[model samples]
Target: GESVGLHLPTLSVQEGDNSIINCAYSNSASDYFIWYKQESGKGPQFIIDIRSNMDKRQGQRVTVLLNKTVKHLSLQIAATQPGDSAVYFCAEKGDAGNMLTFGGGTRLMVKP
Candidate 1:
């Protein structure tokens, strides 16, 4: 079994600043990783993803980076807004199958 965990339980950022959230995974064999954002009551929403073969991936306002050497993952958000305030999680899927192991989550607060 694999486990994922965030370095910080909470992250605070100003409305127009860039934010970085980090996570660590226990499984060195995990080949796929994803970042998700969950609002106050809704389910987790897909943000971005990166595979073990790739070091970095970019989305609209987000970037996902994978450091297989350290079994670490990170999500970077540019010009973060209040709408970005939510709980963020990193999930990993290994060769074992489709099941994804998710991290506890980091609460991101975008201040005005």
Candidate 2:
């Protein structure tokens, strides 16, 4: 069996500091990746995304980096806020793209 998941189950950061969440995927054929932020009692929200063809992509306050060589992915959040505290998930899709395989998720706790 293969696994596609977060490397850490939790991450704690100061409100003004930056945060980095990591993920690993077993399927090398996966060509698309997405990072999602889920706050308490809400659905997952799209944070950022990266393609296998590109190593990195950025959004408002988020960045997604992918390393196909190691099947690794990371999400970087700038100036983490209490509002940013949530469970973050990394997902991958093969050529089909929309059919996603998700990571276990890393809970980001921003301590003010």
lDDT of each: 0.89, 0.86
In angstroms, give how far residue 26 of model 1 lies from its true place: 1.1
Itemize residue pairs with steric clashes in candidate 1: none
TM-score of model 1 relative to the true fold?
A: 0.92
TM-score, one value per model: 0.92, 0.89
Candidate whose TM-score is highest: 1
Residue 37 of model 1: what lDDT?
95
Cα deviation at 79, candidate 2, in Å, is 0.8
In the range 1-112, model 1's lDDT, one tens digit per residue, is 2243435478999999999999888789999999999999899998888889999999999999898888899999999999999999899998897899888888999999
